[model samples]
Target: MHRTAPRLARILACAAVPVMLVASGCSSDSDGKPKAEKSQKSEKTDKAGSSGGAALATPESEKKPAVAPVKFTKLPEACRSLKPKTIEKLVPSTKAKAGTPGRSTDLLTRGSCSWNGLDDNGVKGSQYRWLDVSFLRFESDAALGTSGKQRAQEAYTKEVAKNRATTGAKNVKAAPSAGVGEEATALSYQLRKTGEDFSYVTIVTRTDNILITLTYNGTGYAGAKPPAVADLLKDAVPAVKETVTSVTAANK
Candidate 1:
C-alpha cells in the first residue's frame, strides 16, 4: 500500500505540472500579444501626432502682404511725345523733324528725345537752339518694399540736385513753378561753350510715378545777342506743360 500510494502521488504531481504549464502558455499568448499590439499602436500614434504638430509651425513672414500697384505701366514713345508744331517752334529749322530718339535697351522704364537746329539769318547772326526731353517711370518693387510714386519722388529730387551742380554753370537759379504737373521746378543757368554764351532752362516735373525733364538751351552766333532767361522759360514752361499733358493722354 505504501509503494502504490507513492506512485499515485508522483503521477498526480506530473499531471499538475502539465496543467500549470498550459495555463501559463495561455496567459502569455493573451496578455503578451495585447501588450505588444498596444505598445506598437501607441508608438504609431506618437509619430503621427509629432508629424501633425510640425506642419503647423510656419513663420508669419512667409505670408507677406501684397505690394501696392503702380499707376503708370507704359511709357510713351520718346520721339512722338511732343507735337511737331511744338517741336518746330522750340527748335526752329531742325534737321530731324521727327526728333532723334535716344538709345535705350528698354523703352518701358526710361526714354528720351532731342531736337537741335541753327536758324541762320544772313550777317545778323544765327540762332542755335537745342531741346531735349526725358521720361522716367518707376514701378513698385516687392523685394525692395518701395512704392512707385515714392521712388519717382526720390528720382525727381536727385535730378534737381544734379542739374543744380552743373559743371561750369553760372548764375544757377532754381524756382518752383505752378501749372505744370504735380510739382515743377525750373532750373536756369548760363554756360559758355564753343566761344558762345548759352542760356539754359530745365524743367523737371513729376506726375504720379513718372518724371519729365525738359531742357531748352540756346546760343547766338555771328555777334548776335544770346537768348534771355525770360525767353528760355517762356518756351520751356509751356513745353513742359504740353509734355505733362501727354502723359495723361498716353494712359488713356
Candidate 2:
C-alpha cells in the first residue's frame, strides 16, 4: 500500500508539469500578442505619417502665374523705317544713299541703320551730320516672370539714364516728347570732338514691346556754324515719329 502511494504521487507530479507548461505557454502567447499588436500599430502609424506628408505637398496649380504674351513678335527694318525725303533732310549728301545697315546677329530682335553726310559749301565750312536709329524687341518670359512690355519699359528707363550720363556731354537736357509713342523722351546735349562742338539729340521711344532709339548729331567744319538744338530737335522729333509709324506698319 505504501508503494502505491509513492507511484500515485509521481503520476500527480508528472500531470502538474504539463499543466505548468500549458500555463507558461498561454502567458507567453498573451505577451507576444500585445507586442505584435504594438508592432503592427507602429507600422500603421509610420505609413499614415508618410501618406499625410505626401498629401500636404505643393501642387502645380499653386505655382507662380505665367507672364502675358508679347504685343509685338518682331521688329521693323531699321534701314527702311523712315522715308527717303526724311532721310535726305536729316543727312544731306549721305555717303550711302540706301543708308548703312548696322551689324547684328539677330535682325528680328535687334537692328540698326546709320547715315552720315558732309554738305560742302565751297568757300564756307562744311556741315557734317550723322544719324542712327536702332530697334529692340522684347519677348515675354514665363520663367523670368516678366512681360515683354515690362522688360521694354525697364530698358527704356535705362536708356534714358544712359543718355543723361553720356561721356563728355555738356548742357544735357531731357524732356517728355508728346505725339511720339506710348512714351517718349527727348534728350539733347552738346559734345566737343574733332576740334568742333557738336549738337546731339536722342529720341527714346517705347511702343508696346519695342524700343526705338534715334540719335542725331551735327557739327560745322572749317568755321561753319554748328546746328542749333532747336533745329536738331525739330528734325529728330518727326523722324522718330515716322520710325514709330513704321513699327506699326511692319507688324501689320
Candidate 3:
C-alpha cells in the first residue's frame, strides 16, 4: 500500500503544475487584459514603428516640381528696323561695337533683310527690313493694343517727370501729339540748354508699339531741313513695315 501511494502522489503533482501554468496565462492583470493579449499589442506597435521608419527614408527627388519650357519670339518692327548708322550717330559708337547681319528664313516670302549689332556695353542691337506688302494681315489685337498704349503712356509720363525732377529743366512741358494720323499717340517736349543746342524728345505710340526719338542739334539746323540723321530713320520705315508684315503673316 505504501508503494502505490508514492506513485499516485507523483502523478497528481505533475497534473497540478500544468494547471497552474495554464491559469497564469489566461488570468487578467490590474488592467483586466490577459498577458498574451498585451504581448500581441506590443508586437503590433513595433510593426507600426517599423513601417513609419521605412516611409521616412523616401528620397527627395520624388518631391520636386516639374519645370516648363522657355518661350522666345522675334522683336517688334518699330524696335527692329533701327538703322545702325543712325543709331551710331545718336549714341556715339565705341571701339567695342559689334554688328552681324541676320535674316528671317521663317517668313513666307523671302524679301526680309535683318542685322544685329552690339554696343560697347555688350548690349545687342538689331534691324530687320521686310519689303513684302502682304505681311500686314496681322493687325494688332484690340485688347493688346489698348493695354500696350496705356502702359506705354504711363511709362513715358513717369520717365519724363523723373528726368525733369533730376535735371531741373526750366519750362519743362510735355503733351500728346498726333502721330502720322495712324490712331497713334505721341508725347513731345522741348528742352532748353546753354549755347543753343536744343534737344527735343518725341515718344510715339502705334498699334501696341512705342518709338522714342531724341533730336539734338544747334539752332542753325533745328528749323532747317530735317537733319540727315532724321532721314535715315524715315528711309527705314517702309522696310520695317514690310518686315513686320512678313513676320506677322508667317506667325499666322
The numbered model that scores best in TM-score is 2
Winner of 1 and 3 under lDDT: 1
Number of the top-ranking candidate, with lDDT as the measure: 2
- C-alpha TM-scores of all predictions: 0.77, 0.84, 0.30
lDDT of 2 by residue, 1-252 (tens): 999999999999999999998876765555556556678888999999999999998887567678899988877889999899999999999999689999999988899999999999877989999999999999998777899999999999999999999999999999999999999999999999988899999999999999999999999988899999989999999999999999889888
Model 2 deviation from native, Cα RMSD in Å: 4.1
lDDT of 3 at 27: 90
Give lDDT tens digits, candidate 1, residues 1-252.
989999999999999998998876765555566556678888999999999988987766765655678888888887888888989998999989999999998898989999999999989999999999999999997777788998999999999999999999999999998888998899999999998899999999999899999999999999888899889899889888888878888888
Instruction: List where candidate 2 sits over 4 angstroms from the true fold.
Output: 1-33, 41-45, 59-62
**Relative to the true structure, how large is the alpha-carbon lDDT of every model?**
0.90, 0.93, 0.39
RMSD of each: 5.8, 4.1, 13.1
**Which residue pairs collide, candidate 1?**
none
For residues 1-252, write the lDDT of model 3, one tens digit per residue.
999999999999998998998787569676878878888999999999999999898676555543322111233343233444543544343232232223545432222222222223223322211111111112223433333335434544554455455352444444544443123222223334554333333332222333232222212222332223244334434333333343444334
Local error of candidate 3 at 63, Å?
13
In model 2, which range of ten residues has the least summed lDDT? Answer: 27-36
Q: What is the Å distance of residue 2 in model 2 from its true position?
A: 8.7
